[model samples]
Target: MADTLVAHHPLEFVVSELSAASGSAVTLTPEPFLPQHIVRLPAGSATAAVAAQLQLPTAANTWSRTADGRAIWLGPDEWLLVGSESTDAAASAARERELLDLVQTVGGAVTDVSAQRLGIRLGGPKARTVLAKGCSIDLHPKHFGIGTAVQTVLGQAGVVLLALPPGADGHPEYLVLVRSSFAGYLATWLLDAALEFTSSSSAAR
Candidate 1:
């Protein structure tokens, strides 16, 4: 019976239409079901022990790829572990348990938050421009270069935004992690704003 269950993308209803109707200068793809965990380390405690176990970005507003996934620094005492896309529930559960054990040993905590948010991969020449319409933070390369991660507000939605490497189009790419409830709204709003840039495309849902 468990095997009969199906996993659906949060934006399943709108992604296809959004992709077909999006502007030429922008590409939006849903990175559904990425394994995400919230890591909290108490102040000045076991930071060294934790570092010995996992590779993490200790600096504020930055992230680094680890052997497992990307570890993003959320605050001096908080981090976000974002793993590759996976649908294996058993494997994810095992991972959560492993992390929980690790954190418990070091007096920290790990919270499995995979289902709490959705990841939207946004890229292309107008990617930053499109984001600028809704995001107040400066996304210029000089400021928010590759590997930068920050928690910010995008179009009224609270998000953990990451600036990834440039795409083949020679422009920046980005990953936006927003609450699942607001994903549809953000996707629709993005496509609507991008309509002016690509008049030939159809209307966004």
Candidate 2:
């Protein structure tokens, strides 16, 4: 018999509602669920071994991506490994376990945080402006450009903000990672902030 398959995505119920409110100046999309492996290596240990197992960046707040997965450096010894959700569920699960095993080999601790966090993609011409309504960071291009990632608060919710490379039309895109519990609140806050921009863009056209 084939293995039983189960699907779970925290943002499933609200994604459609949020997407409906998206507009030209600022579009929001719930990122497809992905497997996330978070690891914490021992202090003073050789990170090269861990990096060898998973292509992780040594610098803080930086991320490295390979064909199979992406790794984000959260702190001196903390890293988050994320696998592409576009792959088959079984393959993604296998990859997550493989990554966890590799971390164990390096004497590091790993946890599967796939369901603990939710992702939202906020993109378009007014993307930055929308985020600025809540975040206090200086999001100017020179200060927070591509590859930059930071933990910040957005409308009372803690989130990891990643500055993704601009889209083909030169519009900025930001990937916001928030706790599953706060996903709804953040989504609503974001949609509210984007309303003015969308309206102005429509009126100008």
Candidate 3:
């Protein structure tokens, strides 16, 4: 008999619900599931060693990306390494193992948390407006720009918000990292908040 496959993402059950909602002002979609490796680097770890291992950012609340993965700074000595999935299952597994080895070489502890969290992408002209309804952080471009990241609360759920490169229209895009359990709740909350904008946009047309 074949081994039981248990891998699943929280948003797998809600794709239809998300797709039915209007996306005029802000669009919400689940990011392609990927392998996320969380690492806790100890204090006093050499900056050069950490960078050599994973392109760790030098500043707090920032992220650096490589061809296959991205490294986000969670705090002074902690980081989250997220790896993109490859077409081949075996290739994906190999890439994950390679990242694990890199962190281990630097004496950092690592955890495969790919299933523990969900990635949500929020974009469109009014993306920031929709987020401001629930998030306390100042989403102004002057305060938060590409490469900025922060762990904060969004509608009673804890999340990691990362500012990605803007869209062609210069509108901001944000990647919200939420626990798997809270994925549905946050998605609903966001859609509800977005209704106001969607309705207004429809009226103007």
Candidate 4:
């Protein structure tokens, strides 16, 4: 028989889906199934397709983006390509396949890791403060400003933390990608820390 098991996202059971506190100065919201592929770049036309300035972004810890997706520079000859958020599994898989084929045409090795991590959207004025409670990385703007992305430790979990441009409210925003197994713990930790900021949304634990 074919496999019958269906995969479920880590934050699926959370009643509130979005947690906010301190008059929205801090917020943690689930952003699941943002298709992603880890690519080991091979010299070819595919690189040009994804490159921002006719070549992959040369700046360390930066990302090259287009309207549909973005390629985050992860390391030497490697990048994480992220597609627009998608709730439909089929669509997500199609997008991943499209990218995989595109890269393979240039002999690049690309792995679909779309289900490997759970995404948490963190933002607001007190966002840095909440993250600082557990993350050791300097959250100061001069050190980790918008457009910066790094693989780091966050609240006892290994995560890819990306500093995004400010939100519509003109406050800082970030995207936290942690392994699914660690999502619950990270969510709880964030909520507890957000307490000081008048935690109110209560998305998960």
Candidate 5:
């Protein structure tokens, strides 16, 4: 069975047949800005390959493969890759060719999930609070930091959380990637939870 990844946020939502999600409202549009890039490394060569290309100061700390070639980065070398679709078809193909040439053997396998998955954005001071209601992982910038990525569970759904750079307001933004099937449900949940802060909005002014 294939799943579609979806992006859910205050700005907009995108659905695809892949398993990875990126971009967030907090990182773009109405708040701070954060760019996300998700990729799969060639099997055992992920760490070495990324090291060679990106030239990280240190080797990646973790790297694992999904049933497909979805490689995930737990630390430095590890990263998770989910196959999905994008509006820029040619660019996607070019990226695939580049990865193939940059790394070793074609890891394990690949899946054509140009249908599942979703993308969403979370920003503002209330962003953390909204996510805290469902996620056990700490969203505090002190722990998560900017440009950091983590794979964790949110409201029982598998998720990839990316911390974006600071916004114009000097507030940090966060990008949340969740499954498409769960977007509507999660959006409703987040809105309901955000109501509490509304009561205090007038006082701040």
Candidate 6:
């Protein structure tokens, strides 16, 4: 059995700990929506709507939005109507109701899952190698470029993976969004697997 209380070792790869202060964990359930991306007709009146929306443009198979955003394509035909966190959900709900009233059809459903999911960031020269131990996806920059968001299985947990802008410090970093309930489990697994590499760095010192 692996010793859980192994003393920390000095190593080349620094371990930065990130944790949410709230001891309470979050549970995230995927609220699948139909018509993933949203396309806006250029002629539509923008002021008639109560909330702000961001238009994400797709380029090179990545999600992006321009300055003065017009429409956002979250997936294929579904686009999230972006709004401030302070904005009332009732207003958005009203908007959804209005859309339904106009079309008299179910367009998309919004589910509240704020309690679930924890966001984490990991990056370093050895980051890619460390991540490869559990993830099946090719994490190489050549294959998984920046701005990419992928949902895949990682360490027996469903994870929402996103590639962010490169580090200005010239290091590689990947953004990991995992269910808060599984956050501790996944973190322990990752750190445990990294022990050898972490220990090796100390041995080299």
- Best to worst by TM-score, what's the order? 1, 3, 2, 4, 5, 6
Judge candidate 2 at residue 50 and give its lDDT: 64
Q: Rate the local accuracy (lDDT) of all candidates.
A: 0.83, 0.80, 0.79, 0.76, 0.49, 0.48
lDDT of 4 at 63: 72
RMSD of each: 2.8, 3.2, 2.7, 3.9, 8.9, 12.0
Better of 1 and 3 by TM-score: 1
- Candidate 3, which segments miss by more than 4 Å at Cα? 44-47, 86-93, 199-205
* Tens digit of per-residue lDDT, candidate 6, span 66-114: 4322233345434333232322445545544554443222233343333
* lDDT of model 2, residue 96: 66
lDDT of 6: 0.48
* Tens-digit per-residue lDDT, 89-175, candidate 5: 455455555554554354522332333344455666666777788888777877777756677777667767766676666777765
lDDT of 1 by residue, 1-205 (tens): 4668778887999977767755458888888687888888776547667854678787789988888778888898888888875757777787889988887876888888888889888888888898999999999999999999999999899999999988777778999999999999988887876776653554432
lDDT of 4 by residue, 127-200 (tens): 89989988999989999998888888988899988898998889998888889889888887777777766544
Model 3: lowest-lDDT 10 consecutive positions: 84-93
Clashes by residue pair, model 4 = none
**Which model scores highest in TM-score?**
1
Q: Write the per-residue lDDT of candidate 3 for residues 1-205, one digit (tens) a residue.
A: 9998765667777777667554667778887777777777766647468665578886998888966678899987778877766234555566667766766665767776777778888888888988999999998988899999999999889999999997665678999999989998998888887876675447777
Segments of candidate 5 deviating more than 4 angstroms: 1-50, 54-86, 105-116, 198-205
Task: Name the better of 3 and 4 by TM-score.
Answer: 3
Compute the lDDT of residue 145 as modeled in candidate 1: 92
Q: Which candidate is the best by lDDT?
A: 1
What is residue 173's positional error in candidate 5, in angstroms? 0.7
Put down candidate 2 lDDT per residue, 1-205, tens digits, no spaces: 9999777666677777667667767788988777787878875456576675577788788777856667778888888777766556566567667766776766878777877777899888989999999999999989988888888899889999988888766898999999988988898888788877765446777
TM-score of each: 0.90, 0.86, 0.86, 0.83, 0.58, 0.55
